[model samples]
Target: MVNAQQYIESSFPKHIYRIFAIGKNLEGHLDLSEYPNLVEVRLGNNPLLTSLSLGPSPRPYLTAIGFRGSGITNFSFLANLPNIHMLVLVNHTQEHQAKIVRDINQVHQCKDQEIEKIKQQIIQLQQQIQSLKTCENSNRNQNSPPNLSSERNNDTS
Candidate 1:
């Protein structure tokens, strides 16, 4: 526990890529600083950690985060982690679980709208490509031997 605080205050060692703080023991320590280089952090089963104090600068690089059985009741800090790809924050009660689901759904809705716009753009491009192919085929038919030869014969007459 003391080493964790020391590492947070001082520059983290180059070898430490991930940190997993579990159990109900790592709470009430007010010196949680930012590990900007830390890739992953797993803090579960910590009943004492009523509120999570996330340090800045570590938000962008964090790829995975898990917080199951923690005492966190609000979903404010999670809204800031943009680089987090995979997260699991399941609680024991239904009300808390519903709040997490609602928050995820709200975020997902915005992403879904963006996805729909991209899909529409892709569809438009495909339609334009198909139209171009049709125009090329029609031009080829007009320049074929049958059409060109008939026109040449008529011109010679």
Candidate 2:
């Protein structure tokens, strides 16, 4: 039996390569284990979707994944997607809900803030270096003796 992945590539449309199921009343488990070539899977704003299975291993070609405002709690499945570049997860787990969203976005945002702080520090250091260089040149000029040619002319006069 040909798998879903094979069928998708061999089908009439030919290039159909994504799954988008958003803002629906979908509940329970949504499995996409067969389609290995899935490029993007956007399942956002579906508050009833509790469980999801995106296969055992990481999809090689999978690039984008969006799952926000859904009932899905555990995002351990996200580790199985290494190639995912774009991800949108917002309000998937509410404060009162029993659903627990692990440390994914929180860690990411913190890292971003840290990077910005480092960049600012780098800029400040560069400015200080420039200021030091200018001061060194000014001090050297002030401390230097008079030119040899001027002294010789004065002696001749």
Candidate 3:
């Protein structure tokens, strides 16, 4: 059961791109600050892991992260990985999954509402454009000169 401190002490290659620390019984915070080139991390089944320290360096290229059966409760660590596209949280209890789902649904609902509002604003802008076109045409017609031949015949009287 190697802990986080032991893992950090180990002189692992800095250029290693992938790490699979599944079931390692890692505890405390696992710091990956040394591995600047790390692209993927899989820490599944590490039941003792409570936190993760991604160091101060920005992992601009990191794309995937997964964790399962860990003691993690705070998800703020995800904010550090701006480019992450895939996140897997497996083996969570049913209640935990439900809570996560609920939070996701709330975010979805808020996005949906914003989308609807934008759609309505687009529709209103289209209507305003049509009204302007109508007004422009009416103004053009009102400003146009009358028939010159009709004025000539009236002058002959």
Candidate 4:
């Protein structure tokens, strides 16, 4: 796996978005920091790899990050990935678990803003429909029963 780093360092691809490494050890994980084009990376079932740093890339396209059964302890490395939206931190202590959830919620306020916009749209539409119904009912009630004089004029026309 270390040799792969030498190969990657020599020639790096610029179009790759997703990378899946199976049965790869911690030695291979070092190359990820060098891959500037990586968006989605899956390095599951690696027993040796514990701590993960997001590294120097802006990580703008990086969204969902999953770490299941990696035996990781410190989650401070996540602070580097500022644009991360959805994160799954499995097999962590209660304190670390709570911190991940809290930090993510603080970073993005989209959930709250979306709910507020929906509420406002609903209220505005409801008021418009109510006004229409009021106008229709008022017109119906004000119109007297069909008069014979109006009926004769309609028949002549």
- Cα error, residue 14 of model 3, in Å, equals 2.2
Q: What is the lDDT of residue 95 in candidate 3?
A: 86
Clash pairs, candidate 2, are none
lDDT for model 2, on a 0 to 1 scale?
A: 0.68
Query: What ordering of candidates by lDDT runs from best to worst?
Result: 3, 2, 1, 4
Give the clashing pairs for model 1.
none
Number of the candidate with higher lDDT, 3 or 4: 3
lDDT of 3 by residue, 13-105 (tens): 778888877777788777787788878988888878888877876677778988888877666555556577777788888787777556656
Candidate 3 lands at a TM-score of 0.57
Q: Per-residue lDDT tens digits of candidate 4, residues 69-123?
A: 5545556555556567666655667787887777656545555677899999999
lDDT winner: 3
**Candidate that scores best on TM-score:** 3
Candidate 3 clash pair list: none
- Model 4 residue 146 CA deviation (Å) reads 76
Candidate 2 segments whose C-alpha is farther than 4 A from its true place:
1-16, 93-157
Model 2 over residues 102-123: C-alpha lDDT tens digits? 3555545665798999999999
Where's the lowest-lDDT run of ten residues in candidate 4? 1-10
